[model samples]
Target: MKHAVTVRNVEARPTAVVAATTTWREFPALWKPMLDEVWACLRAADIHRGCRNVMLYLDDTPRVEVGVELTQPCPLTGNVVSSSLPAGRVAMTVHYGSYAELGAAHDAVIAWCAKENLSRTGVRWEVYGPHDDDPAKVWTEICYQLS
Candidate 1:
């Protein structure tokens, strides 16, 4: 399916993430637990979340950072760490379907970047929106940093 791609500047956002190194096929299994861990930490720390769930991917090996955007950075330890999503130009596209179909949205953004002669910084992430009983109604924003 054709995707509507947009280019915009996004400000840096602070996040507390649980980092993991896993293959694409194992991502969901590993990340679900990590996401739960992150939320638990936030609750324990009494930190207010400012934005949606974000999963930053550094490569195809999929070094994943399961994170929740925070109003401010809070101290974290052990497997969970604090980081910021970089501020800069980005290529964005929304994926409207089940998580299983998200790869198409990623492909669309990468193709769009290539067509536009935009070089990517190899930092990409997905911002998850509200969940719906109907998978078709689910929304996720695929964002790629542009260089």
Candidate 2:
């Protein structure tokens, strides 16, 4: 499916996350269990968890933080620690379908940025929407930081 890419400013948000370094292919197996760890930590801490999940990618490495947005800044709890999504301008697009095709959304953003001569900052993230029983109803927002 064709994705419409847009540029916008986003604020830093506090999150409870589990950091990991894994290959792109290996990440699919890690995200769910990682998020589960974060969720358990949040529940034990009596913190409210947001409805969406996020996976923040670092600029310099394969490391990623898979977790949920926090309602407020929180202290470290177990391996689930305090981290914030950097505030900045980003090229964003929402992939409206199965998670299997989410990479196409990222590719769309990459192509859009290149066509517009916009340089990416090497950092990016995916905000996963609530899951659905039907694969066609899933949506994930891909955001790449802009330089």
TM per model?
A: 0.86, 0.89
> 1-147, model 1: which lDDT tens digit per residue?
677999999998888899888988898678888988888777777764555798998777888789777766566766789887778999999999889989899999999999999999899988898778999889998889998
lDDT string for model 2 (15-55, tens) is: 77899888888887998899888888776767654547899
- State the RMSD for candidate 1: 2.1
lDDT of model 2 at residue 113? 100
Badly placed stretches (over 4 Å) of model 1 are 46-51, 72-77
lDDT of 2: 0.86
Please list the C-alpha lDDT of all candidates, in the order they appear: 0.85, 0.86
lDDT of 2 at 126: 89
For candidate 1, which ten residues in a row score worst on lDDT?
Answer: 43-52
